[model samples]
Target chain A: MNYTLHEQEFTQQVADLIQQTACILPEDIERALVSARALEASDNVAYSVLDTILKNVDVARKQQQPLCQDTGLPVFYVHYPCGISTRIITRCIQDAVVQATADGFLRPNAVNPLTNKNSGNNLGIMIPCFHFMEWDKPEIQVACMLKGGGSENMSIQYSLPDAKLSAGRDLNGVAVCVIDAVIKAQGNGCAPGIIGVGIGGDRVTGMQSAKKQLFRLLEDENEYPELDKLEKSLLAQLNKLEIGPMGLGGKTTVLGVKIGMVHRIPASYFVSVAYMCWACRREVMSYKL
Target chain B: MNKKIEMKTKHIQLPMNKINTRKLKLGDKVLISGIIVTSRDMAHRWMMEEKSDIIRPYLKDGAIYHCGPIMVRDGEKWICRAAGPTTSIREERYQSNIIQEYGIRCVIGKGGMGKRTAQALRTFSAVYLSAVGGAAVIYANSVQSVKAVYQLDAFGVPEAMWVLQVKDFPAIVTMDANGNSLHEDIEKKSIQNANQNQ
Candidate 1:
């Protein structure tokens, strides 16, 4: 017999998940911000900015208000055991999104590209994008991230072996491309940002993998030794850029760096960078079927 | 090159004059009081296309905020749940015109504006202030009242123009009337550092 999920109960859980995720700054992100704050001098502009950010996190959690007005595009990743209907799960998530929007946990972010009209309920085609996978586990696992538009605008992709950057198809070229993206993003990406780097995949997969890296905890080390070293080196080099918090200049430009790799076709060499702001609102939940 | 920028806090009243705006310098922290109007992407376009007369009175010598607040209704009154600045660069196309035409003395938002907007601030004797990017609740707490709203029905909540009365709303001057822009300075220095490292 296949395990089943109670429809209404599951929907309510997802709604609760949205509320919790939107209002609470994840512990890892909050800790990273606290550590970053200590790096700056007390009287510096960067210190004040970090101070306000820490206070904002506290106020949002205490008052049950959203961490950001943009609440962002709700992207969900779900994994379920075999025989559980993906259709039902998607519908439940969609319903929960509407309930959350009406409750003010999320803003009306979905809009029609051609008409320039907002759906006004955070629902549109491909709105609240979903990725589903079948796993061996008996329970369902879901993770959601509220990615704001400012940071989304800063995400970039690059083709290696480029003459302009003097970048080859090697890791050195990847480093150069990543630094270039950071320079171009400046404070625009809401600096003291977190960066997710994806290497050696085709364009779309590279970008997708890069975004997936953001779901990792700030303190988690890369499984691959080379990538771990690369992450550490990039973090140090980015802070050295002195873009600081909001690009006003300080010692800390980024709080964390996560990198992932995938195999690519020989014809193409794509490097994708996903820049996440300090807010970094993401959460994970597990449900027993 | 970690140069420490010392900041001093000042409380400012609305409908400010050129002298006050010009007097403010980069890196000064400010707590603003009185009325300010929220205008995002759609509102900016409407202001330029229709030349909104309804909001002009409130904006002249007043402030324009690049924000889209999340609002919830309690009985008959509207309560702002989360209110933080959005990126100001998206409004660059209409911002210079809006600043000049509306006599806007201050522009508030996050992720600083571009060279064109900075030039307008210099020419018009205004300032660009940046709030923390994700500090929505802190900003919403400063709201004394929801004074009025425009284009709510037509433009939807996020894109609507909300006139709010606030007290002690905090921000920092990143761009001043003297053509000094911390954003531009930081960008230039960072690029130089990147090139030299290469």
Candidate 2:
């Protein structure tokens, strides 16, 4: 059996990825919006915003246009198979971004933070970082999301003494802290959004887990029932705050709360929260050929 | 069901072709039918640094969308790439000054503006319109024409201002001329509710 990697194949894959982003709103995001609409309290400003958001999704899908204009900084999660060259894959991604930008599928959002210079090709320093995990399978899977800065600004982390602390911890305390962080966000993260919570792990691990957890399908079952229940409860509590859509006052402030947990050292339980805006642009692709 | 109460307020009709910032109101649901220019951080910085009157021609009764659009060129024509509302917070430092200096009346973006901008809105009779944050493509459809482009040749498209002709552009009245802000209202209410629950 022979597996071949070609530049053309790479380019096509990238183009396909970009084009797919144009048409398909990610399944998780679609589910989130539907759930928001269903859970949304009727006849309020939030409901009106949701209605407009739903309409936007419909229009975006039909026109094959990007859901939100801030198409955000392109973040790629690449799972490389054993024996794959990381450098080649990196170059492929960079080339793909340039092609995608040239094709008008992506906005060149990469810029030098200090110099305020635009990276014309959408390729910048340390961008498209590859997190390698060895899988037994020969195939590679790449997941990409245009994580807009609006929502990215809302990510939070807390290091706790133990995993049991959160469970045993004051629900009210937890709620207050979360609400405080969100309110302080001050409509910056684009409300009527989803929150991804990762509990238990080291600081970096917890943060990464929280972000990766965002890729999970909205309808998918959590492996841990306790976590799932907590997520549902948090979702309800968050919406009850009536932060509404765009924080203008409505019942559906949070679309859902997804909690991902892992075993932590008995001494420490780290928690992180990642917020994703209504655009929630993420795509998963398994490459062949 | 909550009562479906509709109250009619004074409606100001500005020709879709042109809009002056001085002619807007608080809580006015405007159907802007005209050409507007878009600029974000890069463009703002450029304008401030250059202090040139490059933006003046585009500002005469024309709206300025606080956006950095994704665009692609087809031969001579530019196609709208993903164009969405950027957070207006970053522009708070520059927006009020830009409005006063450029004679800009209507500014379109998302999230909220700060105290300075709210004051500018009140004093200048300019209005801040909130477009849905992530709905880039839907907002782009309101753009019926791409009239011109500025700067950002080497920096790619996001830094450039693409003058656009828009029709019935939908935006919520966020900051009004009377020193009212929906964002501030929401924040206060949210904190109040949070405190009450506590």
DockQ of 2: 0.55
DockQ scores for all predicted structures: 0.61, 0.55
List candidate 1 segments past 4 Å from native: B1-7
TM-score to native of every candidate shown: 0.97, 0.88
Residue-level lDDT tens digits of model 2 in A1-289: 3456676787578667866765467766777777677765554555656777888888878877777766667777777666777777778887887787766667777778887777777788876555766576667677887777789987887654235333333334345445655676656788877778777778878778888877877767678887777777777767767777776667678766777766667776666788877677778777763
Query: Could you give the fnat of all candidates in order?
Result: 0.79, 0.77
Error of 1 at B69 (Å): 0.9
Off by over 4 Å in 2: A1-3, A38-44, A159-175, A262-269, B1-27
**Candidate 2, B144: how far from true, in Å?**
1.8
**Best lDDT among the predictions, by candidate number:** 1
Q: Candidate 1: DockQ?
A: 0.61
Index of the highest-TM-score prediction? 1
